[model samples]
Target chain A: MIINGKLVVSSSPHIRSVESVQSVMTDVLIALFPAALMAVLLFGYRALITMIIAVLTAMLVEAVWLRKRDIFNDGSAAVTGLLLALILPAAVPWWVVVVGSASAIIIGKQVFGGIGYNIFNPALVGRVILVVSWGGHMAGDIWSTPHPFAFGFDVSTVTGATVLASPEKAVTFSLPEMFIGTIAGSMGETSALALLIGGIWLVYKGHIDYRIPGGFMATVFVLGVVFGGGFYGNHLMTGLFHLVAGGVMIAAIFMATDFVTTPVTPGGRLIFGIGCGLITMLIRLWGTLPEGVTFAILLMNALTPIIDNFTIPRQFGGVNNSA
Target chain B: MKAGNVYLQDLSRGIINENPVFRLLLGMCPVLGVTAFFINGLGMGIAATAVLIASNVVISALKNYIPSQVRIPCFIVVIATFVTIIEMVLQAFQPDLYEALGVFVPLIVVNCVILGRAEAFASKKPLLRSLVDGIAVGIGFTLALGILALVREVFGQGTILGPDPDSAIQLFGAGFEPMGLFGQPAGAFIALGLLLGVVNIIFKKFNIK
Candidate 1:
């Protein structure tokens, strides 16, 4: 190919964008900051400590495993580690953070040939393993009461149930509180507002598509109204409650929209999002678990290849006429 | 090859090159079913090994008499007879293991390993070679089961050898939490996959076919 009288010889991907993996990952990390900051603000220093341990452990594990000195600079491991920590209960032990982070890097990413080759989101994989292995710590009464603006205070004094666990609590708890994240839940998943801020930033940066989160939240809203039992004398409020409560916001916005694990095609992304919403609501309604966002995203991640294969757009005039 | 070298190759091949579980992936029923605990795996392995050896010997000796058309039924009959004998012996002597192994002991009649050897090796080879192959492959299956069970038990239950908490072997300290998922069927698959990957890498490192 010739451009401006200069001959260019290259393989496919002839038109290259300025965006690299590092830049994309960096944008994701930046986008995740609002939730991370909210987590620390709500849960205090323990959340900060968990996030640090997770990110450091993930980077160290990847570097040592790959024997790549500059792996920490790439920002993927940091994103994975931060994401894992975000989904964990703020009261979890430091060792849990380390183990989860290491597993995220090793079994989730490296064992599957690393980075783009991995089928599931590395953070969700780690969180799922942690949840399975240590349910007592990851779920149930592990939720700590948020002491917003009380930074450096030990916020682990009071144990509480997430709004999703006790839907009756949603009747008294206003939607504004849930949006601002003054609730008991996983570190980064409590606040719908923070996640939306990050998600919007990501969308604006062109790092993630809006279709995934839009489809996911829409399905959850529709199903939540139908099945959420009309809390606070209104089914629509209950639907909005489902959107704001538990891990729906974080998962729909951040985890399900992960570049490596989610579908690439526009149609496939929407399908993947809807699938996540369906599984999440199914588990939340009928299954034993209170929240199903992690499992839902992971399950959808496994189907990404199939979704992409089916949703691959045909080339212009490529269809057979005499089939 | 020399007689001793041929025997040695036959022994080592089953352990590594043609490992029934990791290599050929034969007899997955018991491999997945009875490998939740170390003792269960050991018991299942021994029972399956005994049946494998007996069946191999009988099938190899009767190979000339057995017609080709009815070979599979004949092989199954021989294998089932051995499996029944082993099952009865375990029930009489080691009832605890018999109960723990449960359906797996009876299921061994259909385990592909025994019939696989009968069809692939025993019916074609001499009695001595068949006996050696049986022992070697049996040991390989036992080793694979033991390794998988050890990983599952130690990680899943924070114990080894037994499922009972009182008699269980504690490898981890009090603070160390057990990964309960490893005790589930899903864990079996993950462990098997990882072990298989490791085996493949080792084979590649040694340039083994």
Candidate 2:
């Protein structure tokens, strides 16, 4: 197990990179905290209840499935549970939460081997399944009214909903509102600021390669400009809103960057991220459904293996690139 | 007697042992895509069966005349011609069913069941036997589609044999409530999966190995 007279006991390169699965998972959870808090502020007590319920349900589902399969090593189940909870709307019913978690764990994760082996993000799969099965309930008119202990703001009964909830209605949200992350949306999408904060932390900690989020958001912004016209501020704000609003921020920072599911090479990752961004923008602009990030991520997830195959890094001193 | 036996075998094979959807797992794109309604399933199955049977007979009769090197292209041309004819006929006479069948009508040319039967059975068989084989396979495809449609219609949309969703009728001469989920794509997948499972079990129990 030696290389070039360098006595090697472990493996190739023998230069260990300073990153572990637990730390990376922790960073992801930490990154999501700000968005979670903003969701609490906007949606009030109900959001908290749903978040707790979703997280616990997801965890239980993952644990039970993992135990049944008799494989225990990584804490991926907890991540799935956490991600699922974050992506869910505050108004999602307890039963739906349970069912969604089960679907994510059983079909999304377990069916395709398990944990890191899943092709698509488990949380997106769960959310989409619930959305399809219980469309009426999930998409119904339910908003978080304000609670007591409010400052002079009296922000109660914001009559709030996601930006994409009604595309026909004229949206007048300012850049500051979107930037500060006070927008009305999913549990993890209330605050763009919070997501940015978390994303920065992930990058600093080296939990994820920065190129993915950078590439993905850039593609989204470019596509938004191209399709939505050069109303730069409005388009930028909306694109950022879309990024922050539903699962985009959470997905981009955490889910889409899944080590096992995403492409290994830098070029492949760029292509994958751009594809996700473009698809999401298209669906948002024209498709029947408002949010397409989850579907886009899943579709790209299915293509990751193929993308890797085509973008494999050349062997050192191998085939000429010009040729 | 031997030739007759083979024809009978081919006829029965598609209906049961080699059911295009449940047994052989062929033509899944349409099975899952178009089985939103029972009528849709029936229409699609019948249309596909027609193309399958006609193409099989034509290919069988012309087997000798076709060059081995160019047989696939020739078979595809034959199949595509029948599919186009079916598409046009449906469009002209049954516009509603035509609308419901949609792009699937033309897609029958690519359906593996028709091509598979031609390559495996028809080319080697006599004209009479090939016709029987085609009919059998077509009916089998139809039966599978029918079963899928029945389950999907009953469970997803909650109507067994009724008018369109906008229109309604009674169940057993009374009123009926549809399970609208069955009308959706997810329900189609679950129903198809369950049907595949049930067919597998029945085959196992009957020792159809």
Candidate 3:
């Protein structure tokens, strides 16, 4: 609209839009806000501090990698930093958050040729690096209880095993409380309601396809109903419990839906979702670790090319050449 | 005199140009396996070098006698003999390194570096040239392993020559938290891969390849 008399040099077959890397990443940032707001409200100022440190570190690391002075560059590093911070415990040491953010940018994003070229969710990569490197800090009976509306109180004082690790902890908090964002989990992943709101926003904006999240959630529910084995009174409630607990909500909503790492075809997206849920349930129900969302998505990310090939559509009205 | 310089080049080639680990990527089995610890990597490198030298000298001496069709099996027998001898020597003398390396010590027989040199260099060249090649390649492999192990150990464990408290020197002091990832098996791959990238950059800059 503004190119009234300008010398415009345009290429063939071009479609214009206001959206860009910055805008899309900004949308993701906006969607992540409710969960982040909920984290600070639930955890305290420490959560806010951790998020800031992570974002700053991620931006700094990416800038250094690109050899550019502009720290925010295209803002994807900020999105990665915030996402990585949200998955970590609120009371985690600041240095761990800094390290995770830096690694997310450098190892996860840049090493593979930056933002759109990375094969795994950068935030999840950072989280997994922290999980593998510092198991004591990342997991175990160190999860701090969330105290909603109390910003000044220390969250680290009250620690307990996550509901996934011990069903008894689930009894201490009701189903409604868990749904409403007051639960002992990661900083941003506790509030299923908040994450769902963000997911709905992302879906409404057409930035994310519903099939990936839908298939992922459905499979997790089915497996939980079958093998979760009445951990919280009934099989169906157990299914619901699995949905809200751990990193399932945040992972299904944000991490699994990563555009670069996931399949591009419509059919392949569903398969990828189902595969993630299956591996996640496998690890949660039987594996030594209480959570498997990060590893599940990453493992499937590694198979994206094969999944895309398998789901490629046949030419219309043509004989099946390979078949 | 030119022939002597040519022989010297043969001895020096493996150190950079034909490096087994960095250049050819041969014997990855041990390169990835034993390079996690400084002492283990150096010991493994030395042990394999010994096997390489012995196997190279013996294989070149017997090249004319060995039948062409069964040369592969003949080379294996020669390499395996030296590997067994080295394994026994390590087990008898350096029990700690033997324990650290464990099955990797016996794994040198299949190490492509030794068998590769035996087939490629020793079998074709004369005994003296073969000996020189062995020394060169052995030094190269040892240097690569030592460098890789040092990188992993310093960052992963925060100490050089660790696992023995009395003589270990801590590089970062008590305030540092070593990245436990570097100590894991996956860390070995990442460290070696990054090292190769840096080496490639240097080689490209210097036009070594």
Candidate 4:
């Protein structure tokens, strides 16, 4: 076919931009870097080892699945691996990390036809699998005490329960400490500051929609204040604590905002985010699990298509609202 | 059909072409619910098969007498009668298995495979053909359960039979950590999905669809 007397290899509506998948993925990696760096700083060399294994395994699995020589194809696998590692405890065995990352690439992504076709975030899928398969290693009291700058020692030797794991101990840890990232929790999730910085970067670059995170955080804060029982402190303080604790910060910023699994429409995204928060708080307060971000986001992810369908924008002059 | 060919085809078709579990995807609840252990799944398969065969023979013989307008109710009554017999026998003899299978044994009455065979094959066919069809379909369902159970139990529980230390055979050493997912309901879905994918690829290759 010829377009304006010139042969064209592709179809129309091809608005070429500088943002190839490689560039977008590279940008995402950059956004995730501060959190990943903070994980290593907080958990030491163990976190670093876990991160490397996860990233490598994810990339390798993707490459093998696609039968491609390029292991760094688009770099989404790398992002998934790093994200998976962030939510996992520093004390998990090397094999668990390997298995988690491999399963993330296979069952989470590839099984759903890869990349954009998947409904749930691959990293969260891996985390849930690890959580269910090895609850003792993944959850329980495995949250390692952060040894900032002590990157050489074994982090697992000084294991303690996370603040979310024990509300009674929540009074001991200050909000500022949790804010600054030195807390007993999963590798990257402890550092609310680091995650916020990454999140701000992603938002500034126009990669993520602000409404989703805004809605998610707002809902969590509101629910925490209402139902959080003031066990650790005042209602407002408990709300603040819920916002910064466990996987809430990390999931609100990274996992829930995933472009593929999340709703595309603005209104739909807000609904999705709020739904995620509702489920998260419901589980945290009443459900058996200490944190419910993974299942919350996954459930919302399953509803994404429906959300998008319902939120289709009404036409300018249309009296009848088709949506 | 030739005399020998008719018998063989009627028997073999249900094993592959009209396999109750794999081909027809009938009776999914038990397939997903009870296949956590090999012994439980095999036991379920055997129990369901017994009821299926009995109902098929009965339904084929009674097809002429039963009115078409109320065929479904008649089928249920026949199927339920066999299920009760099987359920009582299991309870009296294999008490452990009866407990292991739990609600699933009685559920065999509503199992779509048995009812489906009765409605589609047994009601229209002669006694001998319906009986042969029942046997074939029963084998297929059992075989499917066995395969699914084998996969789930070996990887999920790391044992065969009942996960019993004395009786059950452990496939892996102590260091082996079974995927706990296989032990849960979600694992059943994933296992079934992956198996279905492989089966689909085979079907495509053989032009079976």
Candidate 5:
């Protein structure tokens, strides 16, 4: 074909989707609202403060780095900032929020040549740095106990360990309570029901592929049954508990399905999800840390390119003599 | 007039234009290994500088006599001799610094900056010019290590000149929490990468190259 008296030749993927970066990012923000609302409702006003600080700091840093006036218009930076805030403890100091948000924008995204060029999920990168830098605040017994429906409650009064941190105490809490937003953990990770609602919405909107989350949860369920002891009487119940525990729901559903950091091929997405599940279980079962979702997804993000390479389908009518 | 300017240029080039750590990226083992704290970086830099100067002067004086095919071995022998001398001197007098530096003091023999200068500069240049190059390169390496250590120590530990925990000067107050990762090996790479980027930007702004 010729255009403007010049030959126009391009690779496959000639039929492009109508979705823009802004539209996709906006859909992600919409999908995240339920979890964000649950976080504020569960943790009180401090959670809102943390989220605001994170999102604003991220946008400001991106704007400064890119020298663009309308940084928040793109919505990607806000999504990253909000996702990072969701995974952090509600009791985290204001400075930690500022530093973590700035690092997510500057070191994680901008340093890698910005947006689609980044290798890892920018939010996870910031969380990892925060975990490494301030393990005391990011993990361990720093989780604030949620006083659900009490928006006026002070966050400083009540503090408790996460379920993963104190499994002996956690065993007393019923499955329904865990599924609701009554557990002590990261702001958004406590409620499996809310996260599932958001995740399903994203899936319905075609913002995320189900195969990756499906493969991820399946691997986790199988491994949980194999590794997780029968704490709730039966192995199946224990596996379900593992599925609802920690950051598995949020990470598998939201983080692993990231468009840029995840594999492009359908087969590659399955492999990527399985890899994330295997690493997460390994860390939870044998590693020193209680939670493994962040590292697991980041490690899988690093392998995305290799997975894409192996899973690339042969061209139409291409030679298959090697097979 | 031109001769004096050339000599000055030789001294300044290594300090910025051809910085071994940031520019040439040589001797990364010691640079990354010992730059966790300010004092360790200073100790490593000074030790490497002493060895680099002695090796460069000796190699430049003996370059004509050494066979071209066996020049590398000759350079190693010369550099190793100076490193051993510096090692003994540090152990006898500065025992604390020697202990802090550990195996890195002896490992200076294989540092690319010393051997790199011997092969690339001293082997080709005259003795006086080679001596200037060695000193200039040594300063550059010291400056690079110092800058990295400063950033790492301040952010990682919230202190400066942290040779010993007792004598370290605390920059932050009691409420301040230091970023512990900055004090680890990973922090060294992050600090070095950011510093290298900033240095490159500054070099471009001023047309240093």
Candidate 6:
């Protein structure tokens, strides 16, 4: 079989991994279902609109670029586009999503020699570009409006409260409401519970290395609990709020878990996760932005090379030197 | 290509032919970090130019006296000295520009363009050629900043520079309504990308290939 323009032959043990690109992408989309469902449930048709626009724009850009470069059959761009769309706030304009999708596909993926060669997470790059370009609109924790979809249940008032922009309003969201994913936020970032469910599925499928996400969440929780007065009662609930709210869960489980951009070794992934956690917490605590998980993931993505360099496994019989 | 042509080459090359930020892609930290608006760009560009020129001249003067092994260290000291002076002067006279430039002004000590020019050209060339090269490269750096600011100012905000008085004082009377996308960090990249594309087209058209 011809593979990606290169004709090659390999010896037996040709141990093929079960996770094909298509399978992986499909699995990721499946994994996102829970979060996407929660987002639609809480935020309504607007979230759906945002996700569709983001995904379509990304895919169209990818297809155009592929045509321009005379390459076909690579599905990574589609995966990236879908992933980026799922992460964005539903209220973001189609133009913003288009710009992001184009940037991610052209600059983050294709410009850096495509797919495995990309140094940073394409979704984070797209998100950051969007944030920086439209700071007041994108970064500011403002919601255009929430369109909560309830199947005959009373969600008109339940979802009207802007959980991200107004902390006072968010505070009023009952623990059960927040836990069961009844808050308005980014299309795939509101429901901590749904994300956790998907994360467990991903872990079960062995599609992702668990070290990074586990370490990242651990760091966020530990630091959050410590600063939040030691994880009991209000503190526990608040810490959980930080965990479930915004992009922390989505990023920890999805974006930060990107295989190519993240470190390979267990220790490297651990360090990467810890760094992401620290930066995310710091930004949440001190930075002007409210949802810092995007920035944190982007910042850590930029530092992956340095992390990889330090965390590279020692060659057998090679002497490590530090003078 | 010849000894006589080297000086002319270095000067013109830095200005446009082989611009640091545009062509060589050196000293990006300041170019991106400082070019939020027009005046910020001008201040950073000028500060960088001053340090570049001073460091090049001093390094050229002491090139022969310094040992080959310790040349980098000696160059740092010279560059650092000039940077310190610039920082102090900016702090005393132009606190706003100083704050605007922030750590980037002091960061000139490590700007690869300054040190790179010093080590690559000035250390070997005569003082006059080195000075010319420094000025040219500095001009080139300033030009890149100018382009970045121009794009950023026009797009990011509805007005050029900050306010009317600020623009008049900082941006040499060039003003325009901002476009919103040009002032942010993403604007920086878009500007750089477009500039790079333009540079390539110009280079190809001029048969400078």
TM-score of each: 0.94, 0.72, 0.95, 0.96, 0.94, 0.73
iRMSD (Å) of candidate 5?
Answer: 0.8
**Model 6 agreement with the true structure over A164-244: per-residue lDDT tens digits:** 455555776776766666566666676778888988889888877888888888888877777755323576766776676
Per-residue lDDT for B1-209 in model 5, tens only? 99888779998898988999989999988888888788989989999999999999999999999999999999999989999999999999989888888999999999989999999999999999999999999999999888898898899989898858787999998878999878778778877889989989998999987
What value does the lDDT take at residue A4 in candidate 6? 75
Q: Pick the candidate with the highest DockQ.
A: 5
Residue-level lDDT tens digits of model 1 in A105-223: 88899999988899999998898888888888888888877989778878667668887887877677888998899999998999888899999899899888888999999999999
TM-score of chain A of 1: 0.93
Q: Which parts of model 6 are misplaced by more than 4 Å? A: A1-10, A14-18, A68-73, A139-141, A144-147, A150-168, A230-233, A286-288, A306-323, B1-14, B24-34, B39-139, B158-209
What TM-score against the true chain A does chain A of each candidate get?
Answer: 0.93, 0.83, 0.94, 0.95, 0.93, 0.84
Off by over 4 Å in 4: A1-15, A316-323, B206-209
Q: After superposition, how far is residue A271 of candidate 5 from its true place, in Å?
A: 1.3
Give one digit per residue, the lDDT tens place, for model 4 in A302-322: 999999999986667878845
Deviation in angstroms for B92 in model 6?
Answer: 12
Q: Please identify which of the two predictions, 3 or 5, would achieve the higher TM-score against the true structure.
A: 3
Global lDDT of each candidate: 0.90, 0.73, 0.89, 0.90, 0.89, 0.76
TM-score-best of 1 and 3: 3
Candidate 3 on A44-128: residue-level lDDT in tens? 9989999999999999999988999999889999999999999999878888898889888877889899978998889988998
Write down the TM-score for model 4.
0.96
lDDT of 4 by residue, B1-209 (tens): 58779989977788887778777899988999899999889999999989989999999999999999999999999999999999999999999889988999999998999999999999999999998999999999999898999899998888887665678887788888888888899989989988888878887899885
Candidate DockQ values, in order, are 0.74, 0.14, 0.72, 0.69, 0.79, 0.25
After superposing candidate 2 on the true structure, give the runs of residues whose Cα lies further than 4 Å from its correct spot. A1-34, A37-41, A56-73, A130-159, A164-181, A218-247, A282-292, A310-323, B1-12, B23-25, B50-95, B103-112, B126-135, B162-209
Highest lDDT model number:
4
Candidate 1, what DockQ?
A: 0.74
TM-score of chain A of 5: 0.93
Worst lDDT 10-window in candidate 5 chain A: A1-10
Residue-level lDDT of model 2, residues A1-323, one tens digit each, is 55577554776787867666766676677777776777677666666666777667666766675675532235566667667776776666677777777777776787777756888788888878777766754553443322322333333335455666664331566657656655555656656677788888878877788777777788777776567643435666555545554557766777788787889998899998888888888887788877788888889999999999888777788877743
